[model samples]
Target chain A: MQVTMCPERAIMEHVTSRWAVLVLQLLSNGEAWRFSELRRELEIVSEKMLTQTLRTLERDGFVHREVRPVIPPHVEYTLTPLGKGAANHLVALAQWIKANHPEVAQAQQHYDAS
Target chain B: MQVTMCPERAIMEHVTSRWAVLVLQLLSNGEAWRFSELRRELEIVSEKMLTQTLRTLERDGFVHREVRPVIPPHVEYTLTPLGKGAANHLVALAQWIKANHPEVAQAQQHYDAS
Candidate 1:
């Protein structure tokens, strides 16, 4: 990554963003995700935030947005090839966290008590 | 990870955050980092944000901040053992990005043209 180009950082952040990680993880199953489906999966995410996150991912090319022209205009999101790679790293990170949660919890308790 | 507790999400967000990832990655070398050294390393980070980031990580037990009394107080930050685990995952994510930058860049360019 060039130190001069913030664009790289910006793009990195897009995929690794708080909500983006979860979204990418969901889409990593190689399935097209409806906006509703994504919302249902990440229940804590607000509609506005989900919309923004999807748009940002779409703009960055990590997510492919498909809108079918019909009465309701079916909309779906899926990982682009690039997104799949990013999702792989994120899932690994999440798994790492889960495996190490007990140690981290102990550290947190130690810190809190100090 | 439980969906009910936002603290898990919040703590996860803290370590995975843009600045935190970089900071943790740097600290993974098992070297204590001074405030000035970290600032110089991450040139783009504002002092305010760095301070906040460090404090948060320290509170969360991911970082240990030490202040030594002297004519000029010596302050240093080091990653705890638990932090080492988090940093490992973050560095993996970063490495994955560098290795796959070409594909991602292509995707970005393709998206822009569309």
Candidate 2:
């Protein structure tokens, strides 16, 4: 399971990247978000990075971007059904880290002290 | 859930890095692996990157590196309990990606044709 030439690794990397993980989780929060909304929500991510991440996710078929013609134009990003499957697992991993931070911190202290 | 300055983000980043994910999946396959064995198994990962990934995982309490007092220095890497939790979720993510690649590919084709 180690060696991989599968394009899926690229998909995995795109989904699990720091910005991508946040993007997936944010979109999966049962709402569609415009570019500005996502930018505002993910406060720490640069606009360029967020756009790049979204493009990668879109290309991977995990994110659907909608564009509407308006006076100023309307655009929104949401997770595809397939993306929901990917997000479910990524969220589990993210929650696990959040829930177990104390144990990880304790281990860090122990390793440091030794 | 977007803006995060939490140290846990760093931990999550370390665990989800490309090499780290592969290493965790390999370890969670219920086997201990020496450095060389891992290098050989993960043929695409460079030695320095693999060592760095293992060190990060070790420092995060997700991996244990056992070094025996022997002539050639027998060292092995395995998942700690905490690491197992992290790996379980990652493996689920990996498996989902692997299982759903066909769906993803179909989506990709649809996107490409448009």
Candidate 3:
């Protein structure tokens, strides 16, 4: 694989990445999330991974990052219009996977047996 | 990340993978593809990678592989009904990425400049 992927593919990869999917799904709820709050919600995500995922999504225009000039200058993340558009599709895909889990599990069992 | 991924996340990863996305999009046209034909269509895909992707999809029940009994046996791969369901969503995502390429490009340029 080439070191630098095409922009479209790269963006697709970014949006569909494991962490990105979860992040997008959460942000789609229309509530702006503080960085710490998001980390709390996503229990398994490392702080470093979450930060990198947010930066990538922000660069891709799917996320809006705002640094609130509060006591400590907290950062809030929300889905941009473009991000919401992408998130809708990703959320649907995630739902589909959830709904079809049984079918896929059966398939895996059959595949492993043969 | 754990060596063994959750089933739903793993399935999501399999379907959205770069080569898998292209493969599903191509197969969604309702054509069964010979391995060589797919290799030809996806010019940059390595033979090993394509083979591995196909096996993964097949095991996941998203792809059906059939072997023709002849002088020289040829294996053909097609999307299963489940595969088609996933492919429809994937193809839509790919189209979305293509259509929104310019917006994303501008965002990247702006991001790079800052």
Candidate 4:
């Protein structure tokens, strides 16, 4: 199909963004994660970037964010049904990369050598 | 899983890169496409960007580039077996996005209204 700038492509870019993909994968376990927990899991992610990523996912309906009113607000993020569906595909892709990355690396080495 | 900068992540990035995803989707039909044909299909992609994207995919062993010696050098691109596997996952993700994007848009509208 001939391509143009479109919303679908934009959403795809969001879903497949580096942090978004990791967030989906982390949430795919069906457990809600506190923002700090998620941050800890993705240790290298900056606070600003993680917050932005979660907001994007939540806005896209792939994540549900709940804030409990307490002395310190307890915030949790979980995948919505739509998000789970997306995560399944992404996790499968991640698994495939994990399993077959050696071959890809080998190919890169060969290509670089030649 | 905590992700640091790693080969698997790098390969995943290449596979999911904007042009890579489009290229794989286009090649999923299993027909060999000439450079001009692909460039035409992805109308907005620059010739240089297309060349670079093809090289990256080619290096990853996801794309097979065959140059036929003729009056003019005829180069054709097709997905390798490995690439076909990756494309299936990406195409599924694309299909899911196509079907559910309306809901996502609605969610975005709802979120924005608040």
Candidate 5:
């Protein structure tokens, strides 16, 4: 399926993406995180998806990826100022969901019942 | 494909959805909008997607839908307080994207070049 690409559409899709938002939220709090570290932090994420999400975010300039020249190769990910701005909003959204999960759950139950 | 459903996951997906964030942001600024009015406001959205997004947001209690008994049917959508909270954050994210689109586009061009 060809997903039509528009600038607004792309940005919305990127930020609200399943793993992208979580990755941004995590990096926002931590400042920087290594690839494996991020994978471990978000246990449910697959390696492929994590890598893909990071690349997409990096391409969008919201994420900065630093590769360290080493024997084993180390990569670190952090947010750019633009990303930090996005992450700040994401954190607020995440916090809201965490704080109001109960009410949302109740509403969902009611919705399902009716 | 059956996507695994989790509350946090669902909430993130719902708010970050293509039309949902835009709709929430619009409602946040205007308080309430009729269905057709919203479609007119956001010229790119399809009626099916708009209704689907509204249903999802309503189920989550972030959006409140009011139905007025009239000849042609009048349904107005506004952010619930919970939704208002979410919208506040979404607006911040949207603003960031708008402000930074140029840089992001430049970055995408750079990425495509190499």
Candidate 6:
């Protein structure tokens, strides 16, 4: 079935996407980082996936990518005002996960053992 | 490289999953719903997807599925205490989406028209 084609839903899906969430969370640390820096920080993300995720977030107006016209390429990403708002919510979720990781861990063990 | 093998991350991924987000949001209304009732409420979700989402949530201790031994089959679902907590966070995000949908729409329009 064709779901309602709403931009709002599309944007949310993009931001809350698996890779998108990690990218946003990383940016919430209040430091602007270059593309490669972000890739290193995320560690497990593929170069292709990171590029694709950043492009989507930039398209949604939640990310700002700046390129410095220098000898070597230097592109940095920062959250836009709207991106900051989304990141605020995402950070809350992230902190919750960090604090309650043990509970979630126990639950998973129980599930696996059952 | 292998990412950290933590059940916490796994459970979070499950609950914050695409279909899982919608399912949790629906259950936040404080009413128990049958499996099919939820599928109808979500509208765009497939039976297989809904069942898979519910099973994951149940396995994580965030959802309770009770089966009634009737002539046919009757299975109902509700949030557990932990599930309620997760649902609370999800409802906040959902409400944010509902309220700011217009802004998101505007952003998307600009993105598309650009």
DockQ winner among the candidates? 2
What lDDT does candidate 3 reach at residue A15?
85
Q: What share of the true interface contacts does candidate 6 keep?
A: 0.26
Highest lDDT scorer: 4
lDDT tens digits by residue: candidate 6, A1-109? 1122255456657867877877887787777879988888777889999999998888777888889788897998998877877877766766666666677667768
TM-score versus the correct structure, for each prediction: 0.86, 0.93, 0.89, 0.92, 0.84, 0.87
Residue by residue across A1-114, what tens digits does model 3's lDDT show? 111237777887898786887888889998899999888777889999999999999999899999899996888999999999898888788778877878988888999999
Docking level for model 6: acceptable
How accurate is chain B of model 3, given as a TM-score from 0 to 1? 0.90
Between candidates 1 and 4, name the one with more favorable DockQ: 4
In order, what fnat does every candidate score?
0.44, 0.60, 0.47, 0.59, 0.55, 0.26
Candidate 5 lDDT, B1-114, residue by residue in tens: 112236776787888887887788888874678999888877889999999999999999888899988988799898888888888887777777777788889989998898
Decide which is better by TM-score, 3 or 5.
3
Against the true structure, candidate 5 has what lDDT? 0.82
Please list the residue runs of candidate 5 whose C-alpha ends up more than 4 Å from where it truly belongs after superposition.
Answer: A1-9, B1-6
Alpha-carbon error at B60 in model 6, in Å? Answer: 1.0
lDDT of 3 at B38: 87
- How big an interface RMSD has model 4? 2.3
Query: Which scores higher on lDDT, 3 or 5?
Result: 3
Going through the candidates in the order shown, the clash numbers are: 0, 0, 0, 0, 0, 0
lDDT of 2 by residue, A1-62 (tens): 64333777877888889888788888878688899988887777888999899987887788
- Model 3: pairs clashing at backbone N, Cα or C within 3 Å: none
State the lDDT at A88 in candidate 3: 83
Taking chain A of model 4 alone, its TM-score versus the true chain A equals: 0.92
RMSD to the hidden true structure, all candidates: 2.8, 1.8, 4.0, 2.1, 5.0, 3.5
Q: Rank the candidates by TM-score, best first.
A: 2, 4, 3, 6, 1, 5
Give the clashing residue pairs of candidate 5, or none. Answer: none
Candidate 6's TM-score: 0.87
